[model samples]
Target: MQKPGADFEDELENSEGAEELYERMSFTVDKGQEPLRIDKFLINRIEGGTRNKLQQAIEKGHVLVNGKAIKSNHKIKPGDEVLVYSETSPESTEIVPEKMELNFVYEDDDIIVINKPAGMVVHPGSGNYNGTVVNGIAWHLQQQSPELTEVALPRFGLVHRIDKNTSGLLVLAKNEKASIGLAAQFAAHTAHRRYIALVWGDFEDSEGTISGHVGRHQRFRKIMDVYPEGDHGKDAVTHYTVLEKFGYVSLVECRLETGRTHQIRVHMKHIGHPLFNDDTYGGDRIVKGTVFTKYKQFVDNCFAICPRHALHAKTLGFIHPTTKKEMFFNSELPEDIQQVIEKWRRYVSAKGIMTEG
Candidate 1:
């Protein structure tokens, strides 16, 4: 495992930090191995492991059978590849655990899916240490077990992350093996991720792709910029489909081919439609709406409804490390996003504006 290095600290100085991956360990299930239950198979194999503990691990998706997460009773067949993995904290930083109300979408011993709300930072960075998703995860795990004596990430792990204000699904590995598996999927662009964003302008084409080189903005180093015709920065691609268009602002669903920092926001802005209310990318101002007082007030109200950027990590899908089975999860649009979208619909209706793509 490589240290995050200076680049990571620089990015976190401004964005509050969420990018993290974990170290893992793996094993293969041989034919000569135990043919009984997965827990029974792992029993006495893992250091300091007991029957109940192994059973808990299997039940929590720790012990994988042939690559998929299975229950405790799952019988390992011949030639099955069994892998066990989890994570501990990096030696560079000490993460402090804090109690928080986090929405757990799915959990097994291996990984956890969290519905991260807007305004929550995912990691402990320079200025911020406690009250982050990582902190909460540590506390949550400690509640489940009494042996979490380490102040660092003993069992806590992070595979992927979204922006601080980007609400929706995020996956975290509970151990080393799970983190490594999930990280590989994301790195290879095999993990299925879909986001819903409201942009400031209408699209000429209903569905299209945005490709560019994304990196720190030359002028505004705190934000992101795009290079259209060169190979100066990291390659980034975003595929978008127009879901609805309300004269000025439009609702879009964006699928990412590469997980770059501020990729969607930068790409959208590069194409002339910044995400609505994204303060970092010059989206707070009225960019597309009419200048009338009523229209201005309406837009302002919509902004107030969803104080953050109008983006949500709506769906996530990935191949399970142990089972290799396709696992997918979806989240509803948060109340703020949902309500603002409805407001736009009603505003367009009352104004008698029918926008044709």
Candidate 2:
């Protein structure tokens, strides 16, 4: 039997919302097949299938035979058709709704554009069950429109996600049709996304492109690694333009040609310019500053000013899924990032004056 966690790795290449939960599997019995209980039959045929899971699906009216919902004891006869609908996994049902304020940038009957704050998780996963954007949206929907809560799983139409520390604009679909429509655009690489990042070093050129394969690190599964040789991982590309130079750090605008997990973070690190104060990509330390105690203290103060990475999803543009119209949204940098930038500006100006004096 296939392993329980087996997945289509190649699908991650073009798919942005890898964690969106919905699955379907179907099978047709052979002409010579003998009668057997549907649950038993499925457990034998489906990879990583368990009788308990099938029973739960059957109880939830997700198991159908010959176009009708069936119980676990329903027998599968020769030439029978069986179908099973599921989420990402049985454990995904644990998502709970919680009341939390959401920053809705744009909202209509079909979609919602949220200006997510830093330190807020986009979805629920290991070590995070409540206090996610999804949970907050779900609760908001339930309170505003209780009828929409009838669905088995309450995702609140989240289509894509930004990192926990990366504050920016994110779009969510209000229904399945809208989700499908928006997902297609993201998969096609037609959606325009721009990010502003403060990296550790100055760029030689005003603009450039970084191309490499991004995938899970073999040694560290929690972080991503760049495969420049194209031997492994999915193809990823980032185009960047230097917006300002601060001797030890540079602020750059990054436009993503392909969205991958940690695409901006991993790509910047690949080029020796990891995002400032990004703990995961080794940006929490002073990568470009001097070795003096004063310099170290200044860098540490900067880190304290911006507790998270100095990256923001500054702009998002995409076609309206239902309206068939162009939609665009922009957001300002969070206060922490802004403060750090100002600090760097003042430090640079002071150093220039000292050198001249």
lDDT of candidate 2 over 10-80, digit per residue (tens): 22221222322334577999899889999999998878989898897787666778867788889999888
Determine which window of 10 residues in candidate 2 has minimal summed lDDT. Answer: 10-19
Task: Name the TM-score of candidate 2.
Answer: 0.75
Highest TM-score: give the candidate number: 1
Deviating ranges (above 4 Å) for candidate 1: 1-92, 151-156, 355-357
TM-score of each: 0.76, 0.75
The top-ranked prediction according to lDDT is 2
lDDT of 1 at 190: 76
Clashes of each: 16, 0
Please give the RMSD of candidate 1 to the true structure: 9.4
Off by over 4 Å in 2: 1-91, 148-156, 353-357
User: What is the lDDT of every predicted structure here?
Assistant: 0.77, 0.77
